[model samples]
Target chain A: MRHHNIRKHLSAYAHQECSKDEHNIIENHIKTCIKCALTVNEYQQVANFSKQIPERSIPSEFIDQLKRDTLKNIEISKQKHYPPFRRLAFAGIFLLLIGTVTLHIVNPKTPVEYISSSDTLKLDEMEHLASILCNKENLIAIIDQPIPIHSLIVTLKQMKKLNQRHGQVNNMFERIMHQINGNVLQEFPTPLSSCKIGGKFDESGLTQMITCLRSYQRYNDTITFRYIASYYQKIRS
Target chain B: MELHQVIQKYQRPMVAIACRMLGNLEEAKDAVQEAFIRFWKSDTQIKGDPFSLLCRILINHCIDKLRKQTFRRFFSITEIKDLDIMKSNENPHKSLENKQLVDHVEKLTTRLKPVQKAVFILRDMQGYSIQEISDLTGFPENNIRVNLHLARKNMRKWLQPILKED
Candidate 1:
């Protein structure tokens, strides 16, 4: 091997890493080569000097302290990163829940909302009354009872007139009208129930009224028709 | 593996490497401690050798300290002293001689560029094979070899006059 080749292998050679053949080659060559021999010596000294640098004795107390301190720091970081509470909860989702709760709590000043329109407020109140007055069974019964077209028209007109004046109709018919009017307050006059018809009529009494109204419908010239006609005419005017 | 286990395994070697790099025992301990702390905090897995990754973190921290040291030196600030590494009540001649050699070698190392110094320390001082050094540092073997060669040559310039006595 050339001098440079042997020099490259010198570190390996110093560590006894070279193959027998390669080691012999360097040995024979360097025996004649003064510079190569000195170079090997220098490499040896370099290795020895580095190894001679004493291992700084880590104090026994220092080792224990380091372990204790490191464990403490690890615990702190783990807690900051993932507290036990967060681990029990649904990880990232818990953070989102915390943020949501914090947001709700941060802004506690809920402004009182005012109805911009009195008409709208009244309509909402009427809608609420309709919901409460017309229970599901009562609504279903009124719908199931078959009123002929004439009774239906007369009942609607009377409901409209009653809503316009008192809005205090008996609960039973009031429920029926509220249901039939599609729960729209405008469909009946405002202030429902013009006068008390004693107490509410049961299903049978309501059927009787439907029959009477159907008879009355034939007399289009009757006073009731005149009154109904006059009311519509007045609304139109 | 548990974080304390990894720290137990690597702390001494890491502190040694950091001491050589930073030239201050306390600073080296702090740097290695920080490395352990970082390893504990990282959610990453140790790909191959846990100790190698920890050394890499520690060496990077040492380099950052060296950079800060440079900034301080530029301002003519006094550097940390109290670099006593010898065992007390030993033979005075051997202790003083070893101290002088260590001082001279470390002083020569400080002259070398950071990359070369690290390569030299990894290879010569720490007894890491070139391949192991490459694996630990992510440097190509050729780059490590070149730096090691340069670092050794630089040190030889400082020590050659004295090694003639040996």
Candidate 2:
């Protein structure tokens, strides 16, 4: 190998990746040539120092914020028309919400029934509702009487499952409660309790409460956490 | 648990390469952030060697940013600052007197073509083999050899006096 050839292959020679023929030629040329030997040493030092340089670390705050920003962008993208992949994600979310809510209403673990005057029902029905609604694992909150606490729990559970269902329940509560309170002002809906339905539980008013609760539930409120998703992959022993 | 820990552990060499190549702490920081953001967002598989993949991304991003006129003007302005660069504890200079060596390396880096700068950073500074350099840059082995050879020759000519004295 000539000086130029040896110099060109010096990196390969250092890495020991040169073919036997090329390696031997370079080795022979370097032995007989002082300049080639010096050049090889220079390449060695450069390669060595290159290894010593450390990789960079970006700030944790920047990364965390970037992920949040990306997620926000993804959410915004869903609202508008997006590319196919993102459109798919938006469709998936919509489908998931519809599926969960429909399942909750259609195939509930406990059948829903209304309380009425005239019939003296068995305590077994109330006990079943209590067991289904008031159980610590199931209840998000309790509400005023006349509408059994179990009914409220069942509705709340449905609301927790889907934003649309939550809105529906909120409207139902406000309309029915306002009518009852309007008929009997002497009853509850006190100043302190009035905020629960904003002093006039109209259909719209109940819808607003459900909306507020939905917002909280959507973001994850501990007050209504019946089934917390576990994110831990494994717990170290 | 935190992003910084991952960067600190896997990205130190990449940061060092960018800092050495760009010779600006702030720009190096930005380059690293952009690279990790790309990594975090990308569905690309981070197989085998995370460090190698990260270094490639960091260098490539920095190279692109450095190509911008605004960043070039910024570099020209910062070049006049003559600040003493701080070294990470792990990167303490073997010879404090070799400040001249650092200067020589920095000057030679500016003369390298963008791809050559990346190739040199990966092979010489980041301790990657030619094959690994090829993997990161998507260059053929022959092309890598040519660029690396030219890069080494340029550095040798520039640093000849400094190395000889040391």
Best by lDDT: 1
Q: Where is model 2 more than 4 Å wrong at Cα?
A: A14-17, A48-237, B1-21, B36-58, B69-96
- Tens digit of per-residue lDDT, candidate 2, span B11-127: 555556677667775666667766776665564766565665676677678777656535554543453332223222233244444544455456556666677877887776666
Write down the TM-score of every candidate: 0.50, 0.45
Fraction of true contacts reproduced, model 2? 0.25
Q: Any runs in candidate 1 off by more than 4 Å, and if so which?
A: A1-28, A79-237, B47-49, B71-99
The DockQ of each candidate is 0.31, 0.16
TM accuracy, model 1: 0.50
Relative to the unseen true structure, what is the C-alpha lDDT of residue B105 in candidate 2, on a scale of 0 to 100?
Answer: 57
* Residue A183 displacement (Å), model 2: 73
DockQ winner: 1
Clash number by candidate, in order: 9, 14
Superposition error at A191 for model 2 (Å): 73
Tens-place lDDT digits, model 1, residues A5-64: 777777556646467999999999888999878877877777677766766667867777
A176, model 2: CA deviation in Å? 76
